[model samples]
Target chain A: MIKSVAIQGVKGSFHHIVSQQFFDENVNLIECLTFDRVVEALITKECDAAIMALENSIAGSIIPNYALIDNYNLHVVGEHYLDIQHNLMALPGQTIIDIKEVYSHPMALLQCKEFFKNHPHIKLVEDKDTAEVADRIHKNKLKGVGAIASVLAANIFNLDVLAHSIQTIKHNETRFAIVKRTNSEVAKEAINKASVKFEANHKRGSLAAILNVMSDCKLSLTKIQSLPIIDTPWKYAFFVDVTFETYADFDKAKSLIKIMAEGFKVLGEYKNAKL
Target chain B: MIKSVAIQGVKGSFHHIVSQQFFDENVNLIECLTFDRVVEALITKECDAAIMALENSIAGSIIPNYALIDNYNLHVVGEHYLDIQHNLMALPGQTIIDIKEVYSHPMALLQCKEFFKNHPHIKLVEDKDTAEVADRIHKNKLKGVGAIASVLAANIFNLDVLAHSIQTIKHNETRFAIVKRTNSEVAKEAINKASVKFEANHKRGSLAAILNVMSDCKLSLTKIQSLPIIDTPWKYAFFVDVTFETYADFDKAKSLIKIMAEGFKVLGEYKNAKL
Candidate 1:
């Protein structure tokens, strides 16, 4: 059983919420300042597991996370999707109209670009984290400054929610993965999913060829993303996630992909989601 | 003859170098703070044309550029590749050993993660811009702080170069495109290269079918990238650049591709350096 988890944010951060969702309620939590530190803590055995957001429906994939996941060789044990609820937060006694400047992460600012455009009088400032931005706004007592953050941030910092679901898109969910130091036995509560990385020949139809192979093998591909192959200029390797009916025939599909691809690796075969 | 060009960044930025290479040195230059501003300047008649970085040799595509180009009907007029030189800089009298913290844009920091790992004593801070970080270090007169920026930044900010070419890869280069608000007649300097973006049907082998059409037409594909169609989750649209032997059959090939693809647009036919 997991006893503790280390995440990279304050108590009201989205990461913290995702971490709690992945681990037991009784588990102790350690908060780090950066995502890299969260990975470091898990690799150094300071934490049992770490929950990292891999992609958002509004912003697409978190590209850096893909590179980190590949470099760290961490095993993704499970996954969860959080419906992101962005709110306009301000110190008590302040209203939305009073906001002269808004601060949040670049992604948050981007997700709420429409709001900023509608309120052209407000300046958008990018910060490290949304929750951290709320804390800073509250602690500094900055007048006429607002933060686009989660409602949890308002609750934790004792601020007022000026607006709710300010994102232009309603389907604002972020996909998170629970990563462990090593592969563990599939927990009964976990769903079955497989993560894969593969490189294709520089030929024109390489990607299409691989997708055909997946279709032929009857693998239901859930996601596919391409990252530049840093070692080779103008070449790319793809990362994919697939769901199978069962763990059965996993090796067969893996072998078939390997035979068809120039290079391929199973990042991890694990239970998907219990949430 | 082109009189002036607008680009993103300060005078010594890589984009500046690319613009100079694409246009004559005598051309008047307009500087913009952001990529969108560069495009807006062209669209609003503040500048005749804009030169923007589209992809980095080491960093892959600058994904947002694709959307910007698609959203605005800009025509690619030319392309150039510039070799990037990343440097570690610090205030005068501060050496690498004396630095306890390093600041840079997130991409630069990620590119130099290995160097940070080797020197675990230093803390990595993410800033908005590399040049901006260098400027901050100079203005603040801070000690024990360094920045990862371009050598041009070190020179501009009067900072000393603590380390040179610190990126993990040596052949780091960025590809930039010259775009105009309105299409121009094909010039003598125009080469046999073209870029296109298309969306295929969400069915098995749809992308393969498009690639097959390109191959059958004997078009040599230079690069292909897929960006998520945000409106339609789980679906992707592909952007491809191809080179042909002559302009004689270019239109025919493009028309065939359009017929095969569910959605397609010819970005431009331009002369570009052959990789």
Candidate 2:
């Protein structure tokens, strides 16, 4: 069992909240300022696992996380989707009408573009973290500044939630994965999901050939995304996650894909999370 | 002859530099604040053509432009790659050592993360346009704030270039495409190039089958990128640009690809730009 998890940002950050949902509440928490540092800590064994949010339903995929996952060779042990409820938080006794400025991460600001558009007079300030914005407002006693953050941030920072779920998209949820240094053991009880990253030759149809091998193996693909190979212009390597009924032809599938692909690496195998 | 081209942002922006390279310096300039406005100007016949930077060599693909190209129905008439040279600009006598704040577009700031890391004391500010940062500094006569912008911005704003080519990567060339409302008549006279966007069924081997059609047709693909369909999670549609030595089997290639793929749209047949 994982005893500790390191996440980027402060206590009230979405990563912190998501980490709590996956691990024991008393688990040791290592806070880092950046996502890269959290991944580094896990790779260096400073933490048992690292939890990072990869995508928001409203904001789309966090593309940088895709690169980090591929670069660090970390295995995604499990994933959970947290329904994101963005709240406008301010120091205690402050009201929404009192806000002269609103602060949050740039992406959070963008996600709340509709709110800003409606309240055009409020100056939108970009900060490093959403929870940090609330913490600053509370610590600095900024009467005119509010933060767009989670309800948990408001509670932790002793701020009042002025508005709830102000995000333009009502179904906003962020998908986070728990990444560990080692891959999970393949279970014999039931078929599990697997993820792999592969590079295809620059030639046309290279990616298609790999997909054909999966089809031939009777695997059901869940998700596939392409991230540019940084060194190569106009070339991309694909990351794919697939589900299998059993581990019966898994090795054969892997070999066939290797024959069709220029390079491939199995990221991890885990029981598919229940939505 | 093409008389004028529309582009996004103010003069000294990367788009402006690319447009100047594609069209002569004497061409009329139509500046818009956003990419969508540039496309609208071309589609509405307000401009003869428009140039938009679609990707930076280091920043991967500009995913938003891909969606705009597909939705706007503009024909890509030419392509150009411009080497990006970012400069730290400030009022005439300001030096990098004296700077307390730096401002640029978020993307530009991200490209220079290493530089920012070294100058940790400098507060980084995000602005809508890099050139605008120069303009603001010039107008405000701010002593300690600097802007990361083009050399043209420094010249136009009468600011000094404190540092040159501060990007993380040395060869930071940005790829741009010229789009027009009408197809180029010179397309057939020059080397044939084809652009297509397609969606594959959410099944394994679907994308490969479509690519096989292109390989079978002997077309060389120049660029391929996947943009999230946005409305769906973990689903993407791909856009591909292919070059052909001759137009002999182009129609057959399209038909074969269309049969194998879902929602295929041929953007246009255009001659590759000499630059």
Candidate 3:
């Protein structure tokens, strides 16, 4: 059982919420300000596991996070999908008209940018964290300042949510991966999905031929992302997420792909969190 | 010939530099603050062509731009690759030690994040545009403020260069697409690369079969990005760039893939800009 977790942000942040829901609420949290620091904490055994956002339905994959996970050789233990909700909050009893400036994470600002188009009077400022901004507003009693964060942030900081779910897309869902230094501890019977990375040979049709192996083994490709191998400009490493009905099929495909593709590595094998 | 071109920033941004280099220096520039506005100016005929950055070597694909091009039915006339260099500039007389804050476009700040690690005393702030901040510092005579922008921006704004090529990665490159409402204007003899979007059937290995067809036609896949089809939960639309030795090979593969893949559309057909 996991006891301590490393998250990129403090309490009331999305990563914190994931840690609470994925593990027990009483779990100890080692808060980090950046993804690199989170990885460092995990590598040094400061925490037993780390929670990292892998992909979002609307924003797509967080490519750098994928690089971090791969470069650090971390393993995915499980996954969680969270419906992201951005709320406009401020000191209680103040209206939107009273707000002169808003501060939050740069990404949260980007998501709720459309709502701000109508209110040209308010200036948007990017801060380090979403919930941290909320905490600052409440502690300092900043009246004219607003924040784009989550409902949990507003509740914890005693700020009134002036607007709810202000993100442009209604169905904004982010997939988070629970990672550790060790390989997955999930049981084979419960494993329905796996994330793998592979580099195809320079020969033509090599990538397609490898995909054929997965299909013949009854693995369903859910996601495929190609990241260029930095040193070798044109060549690419393919990161793919596949789902299977049976573990036996996945095992066969894994063995075949390892032999077929260059630099083949299993990033993770865990339960599919989608359904 | 191209007359007015729409770009996403002021005269000294990377996009602005691309506009001048891709077109002539005498071409007209319609400046917009956001990518959405850049698309609006293009769709509304405010400009003849718009330059959009498709992918960065370090950051991977800018996924939303692909969606915008596909949704607006824009045609890719050509592609350009730019070597990005970020410089730190400040008002005349102020040194790096004197600078208290650095303001720039979020992307510029992100790219040069590693350089600022040693200067923990300096605060990094995100702004609307990189060159605009240089202009602001120049006009307002902000003594202790620094700007992270291009060399063109520093020259245009008459700011002293405090540091050169401060981005974490030295060989960073970004690929740009020259898009217009009509089809590609290049001659067939010069065309060696094409960008195509397709959705495969929900059957197993449908995507692999499509790839097999491309390889059979001598088309070498260069870049492939999969964006989730919003309405369909697990389905994805693949955006791929392929290059060939001859245009006839690309044409044959295009026809075959069009017949095999669902929603197959050519986003752009132009000369490969890799070289």
* Most DockQ-accurate candidate: 3
Give the whole-model CA lDDT for all candidates, comma-separated: 0.77, 0.79, 0.90
Misplaced by over 4 Å in model 3 are A119-121, A201-203, B92-94
- What candidate 2 gets wrong by more than 4 Å, as runs, is A56-61, A169-173, A186-191, A222-236, B43-45, B91-94, B116-123, B138-144, B182-186, B189-191, B222-236, B272-275
User: What local lDDT score does residue B187 receive in model 3, on the 0 to 100 scale?
Assistant: 90
Alpha carbon lDDT at A34, candidate 1: 78
Clashes, model 1: 2
lDDT of 2 by residue, B1-275 (tens): 88878989888888888877777898888889888789888888888999888776554567667668878777777788788888888888777788999989988897888987888889987889999889889999999999999998898889999889998877877778888887766646584777788886456666666766787787766666555455575465777878776787677798787777778888768776522
> What does the TM-score come to for chain B in model 1?
0.84
Second chain TM-score, each model: 0.84, 0.88, 0.96
Best-to-worst lDDT order:
3, 2, 1
For A96-117, candidate 2 gives per-residue lDDT tens digits of: 7788999899878877878778
Clashing pairs in 2: A208-B208
Ranking of all candidate structures by their DockQ, best first: 3, 2, 1
Could you arrange the candidates by TM-score from highest to lowest? 3, 2, 1
TM-score of 3: 0.95
- Name the weakest run of 10 consecutive residues (lDDT summed) in model 2 chain B: B225-234
